[model samples]
Target: MILWFLGLMVVGLYLSFIMMRRSLKRSALIIVFGIGVVGSLLLITLNDNAHFGMVKRTTTNEQTIYTASPNVQMPMLLKQPAGTADKHAVYIYKTDPKKKAVHTKADLAVRNEISRTADTTASLTSQTTRWEYQNGFYGALFNHEGAGQFVSQRNQLAIPKDWFILTTTQAKRLSAKLKVLQHPTAQQKAALATKVKAKAAELVKAEPELATDQTTLMKQAQKAVQQQLIQQAVQDVQQHK
Candidate 1:
């Protein structure tokens, strides 16, 4: 609709210019051409302003709330209350620090347990450790973080049950590890792959349901890991350059 209006304005201006060049009566040409030019300009300005004005109005009304740490932006899922569009009416609160602390401790313990078990059989490489973390409690915690963000942003207290098992600290730690893997040495990469395979085997043994679809699961896991690694590598290069 806006595009059509703009196109019409352009065509009107072009026609007005052509008419001024061809018309024999100078006064008549000036008056007609002047009206066309002024009308087109007014229509274009009004239409553009109306479109942009709506966007600005909507954005102002739907305020995006963030936690104390700017890194974690909460999802907007709540609807505005009946008969109210006031920004001040929106509820905002900090995430519970004590709950987050407890969850982080539990998540660390789980990671340690996995590392100890993997070590008893063979030396765990960075890659293997990453795979294990993704396939285990770390993966579960990621889901919680997502859910927590949604719940918190909506000003709701009832978070996902899984949120009680992981915290923001664990999520940050996993993110740091991923960044380190972005620029691994060749030997480290090889070691990581070997460890990953070993961890996958361990997972199959521990989870019988995964045994039936192990090949498919491993392929999916590998694809997800590689995509993240590639993204991290690109970010690292761009940042340094």
Candidate 2:
């Protein structure tokens, strides 16, 4: 009896120990799986952040976003197109007298001023400067400050005083008259031939036969014709280029 009792006790203790061991194995497996899932999520988040940082850095450093250096002491001209009331002539002139040459900005301004008619008064958002695009060539006259007298004296050629002292207003008027033939109205088309004849007479009067050698006049005419032909060809290419 004592031996049977001892054997039963030993069997019960062994069964309990086996059950405890199985429960511990199940708990350990669940904990290890949870740890693995958490680690994977953390790694994915870190990778995403790193990729975003790289994209931002590359975009911020691109050359397109960088500002180009501004040029203030450059000779620049502004050209605008007059309104219908003013006969729609093209206005060309200098904006800066200090600079002797036009720049990329000036070229763009000339085009914009024509289409919009606000070159002189418009405030460019890109750069803060007052650019004037009056009726005629602005050049050194706009920025003469104190050299007007000298410039006026130097411009005195043998031409008639009226022709020599041509104003911006006159230049604009001439440009408008020339532009009239492009897309003429009924009146313009009807009188085209007569207008051309009148234009030739006016040109002759405005730029009368200056006291120059006959040979020089012939050379000048030839050069002007050649330049016109070349310009026409270039314009054709630009229109179709």
lDDT of 1 by residue, 180-233 (tens): 776799998897687567666766777767768968758755665565554554
Q: Which stretches of candidate 1 lie over 4 Å from their true place?
A: 1-157, 161-177, 207-214, 220-241
lDDT tens string, model 2, 99-197?
Answer: 342222322222222112222321121222232223233222223122211110011011111111112443344335435535669885566445444
Candidate topping TM-score: 1
**In candidate 1, which residue pairs get closer than 3 Å at backbone N, Cα or C atoms, i.e. clash?**
none
- Model 1: which ten-residue window has the lowest total lDDT? 52-61
Show pairs that collide, candidate 2: 74-99, 75-99, 75-100, 93-138
Q: RMSD to native for every prediction? A: 23.8, 26.1
Alpha carbon lDDT of each predicted model:
0.38, 0.33
List runs of model 2 lying over 4 Å from the truth. Answer: 1-50, 55-204, 238-241
In order of appearance, the predictions have TM-scores of 0.23, 0.22
